[model samples]
Target: MTEMLVPTELLTGIAEMDGQHDRLFQEMLQVKNALLAVSDDDAHGLALLSRLADDLVRHYAWEEAAARRYGVPFADHAREHARMAAFVQAKIDEIERGVCNIPALMVFMERKFESHVAHFDLQLGLALQAARAARDAA
Candidate 1:
């Protein structure tokens, strides 16, 4: 099954956040493409997954920093970030141990990405937008 590209509509209005989102979208697309091209190559999928996880870490770090700078209630956001990061890391660990399910992992990631961006990231963007407006008004 083919995964859809991350929707552009989800891009946050903040430039740094938006740039990170764009890069993640591109990286995810590349990973999905690589997966499609090498269904039988576990090593290839593993490499792509590792890179994807690494990119996500970088993106989350940048986002968390922005959240902190904007004073966006880091407690809840930090929990969400930790959960997502752990999910990806757990899968990678399982893969390393030769007990991972690649198809299931992809499905989980695709669904998780969609739901996460829709709920968590959307709220983050809205919060950032509100904060920016408030700063501007002041």
Candidate 2:
């Protein structure tokens, strides 16, 4: 699997979140590669996809916990996460039914992930940083 560099714009300035984002990107790349490979074993690709879905769920839970700890408003963020999870599951179903366009699906997922990091996650990161700074200053 080719290593994908997380763009600087995607960095949330929170170490753990950044690391998770990196891992997620790598996992997505692996899934894309596996699907694109000219092999009869699509089982490997499907497994990778399932793992990516699971990792995303864990990542979302971690972020939600951090948001609560930092006192960031989380209802909207949690709703967005739920929507994304549902979308991923639907896509996985499509893939399982052999109706997926692998490249397009990968591209869409990558863009959606990047947009979420930029808009939602970055806001949460900023809130977390401010909360920590305030606590330290007290």
* Off by more than 4 A, model 2: 1-4
Per-residue CA lDDT of model 1 for 6-117, tens digit only, reads: 5766755666766666666667666666666755666776787888888888888877887888889767767777898899889889988878776677777777776777
Q: Which candidate number has the best lDDT?
A: 2
Worst 10 residues of 1 by lDDT: 1-10
Clashes by residue pair, model 2: none
C-alpha lDDT values of all predictions? 0.76, 0.91
Candidate 1, residue 132: CA error in Å? Answer: 1.4
